[model samples]
Target: MTVKMTRLRNGIVIVLLIEFVLALLGYIFISSKTSLVLATYIFIKNIIMLALIFYASSLINENNISVSEVLNDEAKNAFIFGGLGLIKYDKNRNISWTSDLFTEMKINIVGKKLLEWQPLLASLFEDDDIKVVDINSRKFEVYNSKESRMLYLKDVSDYIEISKEFEDQQICVAYITVDNYDESIEQADEQTAASIQSTSRQVILDWAKDNGVVLKRYKSDGYIAVFNERTYRKQVEDKFKILDIFKEQAEQLGQVMTLSIGIGRGSNILRELDELAFSALSLAYSRGGDQATVKSNDEPIRYFGGNSESYEKSNMIRARVIAQTLAGIIKKSDNVLIMGHKQSDFDSFGASIAMYAMCKAYGKKTYIIIDYDSLEEKTKTVATNLCDDERYRGVFISPLRAQELNMSNTLLVIVDNHKPSLAIDSNILDIVSNKVVIDHHRRGEEFVELPLLTYLEPAASSTVELIVELFEYQKEEICVTEREATIMYTGMLIDTNYFRTRVGTRTFQAAAKLKELQANVGEAYKYLEDDYDTTLTKLSITQTAYRYGEGILIAFGKLDKIYSRTLLAKAGNELLGISGVKAVFIVGKTGKEEISISARSTRDINVQLIMEKLGGGGHFSMAACQLEMEDVTRAINLLEEAVNMYLDERKSE
Candidate 1:
């Protein structure tokens, strides 16, 4: 819009100037007469030209307000193209300009009389480093060496005055939450919890009032405050220290507190500010939470933390509600479609099948979206058999087929992963807005908004366990059939390394529930049974693995179609168990598909951060990423460097 307006204004100026010249030349040639006649003709021509210029200028100015207003708010492209200017004003009623790229230009509104205006104009020239090319009683044009174009008279005075109205609009809201409050409270007795809450509230409210702000308690641990820039800046030149004050206050109260802060500005457009604040708070949480941070669109993130412990309780009740909601959605929808990450593994495929069974129990039309031709032979066999069953006839289909059949009423159950980009048939997501995510991985960005339900427990071993827990919560002990229970049990076994890794009370309880449902635990182990050839291949690949850093392991090998991811996880875990090993990483070429990398770590290290550097993230103890790097050696070298850097940073810290 700004570009178009600029072009239109320039075009009109050039056309008018051309017409003025043509008129003058024509008048001179046709009316060469007495002096009075010639003078009158020149006067009329000048007046007409002046009127045209004013009218043209007015038209441009008339559109400038709306154009500037829209560009300020709705111009998403302004970040790439220059955005509209924001007029600013000081407390003393002085006007200024602001933009990320545009410099502030202050113009003095001078003079009660014609002569008095000269001194004000001269002072503006001297102070602003601008030069006045011409000055008249009611108009002036100024030029600056730092920028192009002459400043128009009305823009300097009238526009600047109008911009002052934005001064009082500076009162802002800061949204803050105490991170890990549930865990903190749970760790303490009732009296201690009350004391801590009272202490925190007083500290926050007192600080807010002292800083000339009003603190409004929203939720139990959340607050919104009104702040002015003047008061906020006076409190902290380096505003990051505000978080330190919170930490100090919490320490003095004999407790720990971590704050997630979101600062909002812009009066008329509070929603944008709210979004920015929410995004900032989310980033703070993702970076392990417990800090006060400011997020202005122009400012870089300012984090403050002492690397404190962050352990919030997983929302088990919410997960149960989500499951019940998902069950209802499947019953109502025309079809239930489930998908998982690409290069489906035991957990992914197993979880998908489990969800399919749950939907089937409700007599809903269901399909498991898969890359049939590209999937592993074993998986294809299971999927084919399920489709061949009379009950599941016309249910199983390729991701491409599912995309065509999906509609708004279709219920999508994205399993084993929440990241939209990682899901099979990600594009199909848009067709069905009614969706649920049953994932056990830690939350990451890129989740679909407004999901009908989401059951994500980062602490849970697998989506299969979440499903099992959901059944227990619903008290539907007999809803899952023997076959479905076996599948769910298989997923839990694969994810937990047959109850050897990440096994907890809930894990054993889930297994017991499956057992009660008549699931053949021994038959579930049959799914884990591998042929001697595949076992030998994994063993040989493990023999080739090399140690990197204290705990990380690296190996490159081609394996038979089976035991690629399973072997990778096994190899990584095997390395991690070795003496003095803190973490492990295994990379391999599974099939003609992309290179696969798996990472594992103990409590002493966070392998998730390492993989996040490679555009992947999971639990701190386990993670994986797939890159398009065809050269395996180069990838290994890069991964080694990443591991070394992470280890070195931990040591230094």
Candidate 2:
């Protein structure tokens, strides 16, 4: 039992003993022969004395009251001995009574002022303790009696300070890595490499010194930083300026550089700290690097420093390994089902068809999953031509049929997109245990989890480029037919905008290999040709374009009938031809209910950030988003708002 309860029990026992003794004395003093009047007088006197003793014992048992002040200043003694301050407030929160401690503290609380303090008091009630700054700063354990309009506070300042000091002394571990270090330094001369490495190391060292952090360079391209909670918080608030500094210095040296930073905190166990730091670093790299990711023991992960573009790693050796792995997985499956994102476009169809051809060569049954009802015009035309061929008949099926044919060994290969929500049918993911993902877009939060094999290269122009690389590394002789070659080349053509943007050396090499397989560029051009009505639509959309935010152009177009996404993208490209335009955004509706925006920019701006804010993602120069709104004007307004916010943030930085 508690101390107060034990004292109350002892007091009750003492009171009972006194009462028993008094009753015994009354019985002894008044005999059976005594008169009724004498016995009644004795009984009354004993009862009065017993009541006085019980009251004195109750005073001694009271937790907040003292025995010495039973008759002298009960309230004053309670406050002094218990080390508590009492404040009573009326309905309006005006102080009705203040104890001696409350008065000495000189708290200037008025009617509404007490309401201002309610949040702190409520937090204390919920947490059992809170820190407050009044006439003097102190930590308190609070007890509140709402019915009596009273509050009690007990001092705990010393204990709170000691706990805080221990927390501030705990160490946080951080791992820093320079992304694509080998690719960046391999081509440089010895002196140039040394200079770049020195500058990068100096920047990190200077930042660590400024923030009171300990740094050690244990590897040529990596560092380990140790700091306390205060320094970590300051680095988070500053958005890890070392990222921007390193990028700036590398650019001056005629090289592109990016850093991935991972911080592990809120754990005292050394093994767990190491694991958290490694997890954070992996997340940063998976998100395309050039960012800082923090993981704490009890909190959700936090992100920063992703405003810049990610440097691409053109690792052919990694690609070859991935290709071989994919072949092995495909051979082991019972059947293969190739799928892509919603509203299938040329890139999606091309990658699916290429996979189909490879599976056919391996003598494995395969089907391409597409939503025929939602195909764009050009993609629909290509699908029609492939279906007309007798050899390619029944190769294309809908998501429903694919599910019906799904088995335990069925392999699902997702191409051109990684987000589960953007899948043709997200339910397919649950049915298939063996899965593979291949895409060229920058990674986002929504991605497939735990695939058998994943080949994602944001540097490639299109998924077709990656697939072509796979075909090159295949061990057996594989003949990519003329039609398959044409389809794959067309996908590359569309994504690279007729070889005008996002084309790398590998992109050209893939195109050359496709030509060697007799891919007809002339036929591909014919497939991309626009009719008279579509040409007039593009002209009208371009005419509606207006300049926004220092040479960024925005256009709003409404279609009487649902048009192809390719046409919408073509309209956006038209606006970029203007001499002064640095970026272009085109908003339109694909059907009765769906609204979409296509974003494009030059090297001066980053359009991916703007689209990501609207719940979509892509490369730095090209991105798109589909919204639920029906009104075209509202979509345009939201687009402008995102653009302005992005520009304003850049300016502030």
Candidate 3:
């Protein structure tokens, strides 16, 4: 009924009959006394042998390969492929057969599933693609064929090693600078200056030699380090220990000069890598130095260090030039609009009012873009009072009103924040073309692409400090009304946390100038004071604080109620004044699914780095982040993890 059976019946059957007759005749001839019984016995013996041969051939044909072919061709091919092995498995993952190479390797796979013999190979049954696996300390590339239920494996240990070696040898570029070199050197005594220069010169060269980085000093305080991926990877593994080296040297000699490093990787072009390195260096430089920034292709920028106070700059010439430039632009524009960040705080609104006074002095019409319905109680009260005045009936306008205005040749000034997403109404940016950014917060990666003018000085106590400085260089004699001066003073007071942080000589001078303008300090203090119920709530939040590290404090608000962003910040500020406290975090609920964390520090630790781990950023002293889940416990847990990670990174060195 089968093909082999038909072969026997068509031709092989006739041949078998002839052979049987011949064998019977020869036996009869040899016998002395032959009988009919003897011939019948010989026929039966011949037929039995023929049936056995047919059965053997039929079994071999089932697999579509003869036994001789399988034993010869497949074995020869397996040897030629250099450690190639083939396995055939059924739907149940049982190994039905294996090539001769498997037996040569002494791996008994025929009677067992790979799940028992080699679990890694079992993954091949789930997909029809090549994968690498380890077997007996050797690497193999396995190609799976789902249609045939077969797996082909070839040794790939040598190839993988060569690829790794190539990657390790790839080039990386770096830029380094000594932070505060020029300022401190000019102010130091002769002997101290000499020591500073010598220390700066030797420390970096010694590090470069030890780390195998090729260093070339281009300027007195700048160097370019060229190294391979292996050396760069060493820094990543150690968390950039160079930052500690710089910090230690500064502490030993009083911070004459510290270091900032920027690394660029994942580029084939040397010039592009150099540009990326410089870009990364600028981020570290802008963030107050004593840090390292890494900018790799297609990866988000990363920051480390910044554990110390940033050096301050007081450049009057730069301020004078920016003021003159801004005056020219404002006088030429048809009108102007001043905008601050969302959820307007004292500093943000105060800076906007200062800029508004300047625009009015220029004799040009300008409006402050604000969402009045969302304004703080004190700020809204101020706006309402000003609206009642005859001199400022149309000064405060909503973002929607600004959008409806004729915007031709309008100049937009953004105060207190540079990131567009934080703008009072981010949609205003789409309608306005000419823009300028002014802020005192530490720089982040998000920024307006191009602007007519920009001033970002993190050293200043507040943006109001910078605006007050610009007041001196204006061509037209501009005088802010008494109320305007009071509002501007409030901005500076709140941002500096009562002149306790980021204060400089210029900050006091600006405050004195406002005092001369009859700015009421009493009114500014009143704005900072919280209502009775809010004060009690803030105290409760701060009182629940527990210690984190040596000087860090962590606390939370009522889990069932919503608190203002300002409330959490105020609680964090109060906790910073506690005995021996260096940093504070106040966690609270803001929305149904949003949890807010406000962080503050006293220069003993960098809170920005800790908060950045949770996707929020701010100055070294203050920062905040949000978690999108409703679980207050989870928010606190994540904040603790961030704190632990930050301390762990610093502790490693």
lDDT of 2 by residue, 436-519 (tens): 999988777788877898887877888998888888877766767898889889999988888877788899999998899899
Can you give the lDDT of residue 185 in candidate 1?
77
The best candidate in terms of TM-score: 3
TM-score of 3: 0.84
Residue-by-residue lDDT tens digits, candidate 3, 454-477: 888777888998898899999888
True-structure RMSD for candidate 2: 6.2
- Clash counts for all predictions: 2, 0, 0
Q: Which stretches of candidate 3 lie over 4 Å from their true place?
A: 1-83, 90-128
lDDT of the structure predicted as candidate 3: 0.83
- lDDT tens digits, residues 1-653, model 1? 35776677667667766665665666677765554465566557766876876687777677887878887885644632432233233333233433332332333432123224334444443566543323232222343322322222322444444555455436656788886566567777988888778877777887787777878888999988777756656544554455666767777756667677766554446677777667666656654555555566556554433233334344466667776777677778987888887767667887887777677777777888888755554555555666666766776678888878847578888998888788777788777788887887755556766787767665577777777777654433236667667767877887776775566567777788878888788877876676887677767767777766545567666432323565677677666667776667788765455566788766566776678667777766778877665666776777887877666554543
CA-RMSD of model 3: 8.7
Each candidate's lDDT (Cα)? 0.66, 0.79, 0.83
Winner of 1 and 2 under TM-score: 2
Query: Against the true structure, whose lDDT is highest?
Result: 3
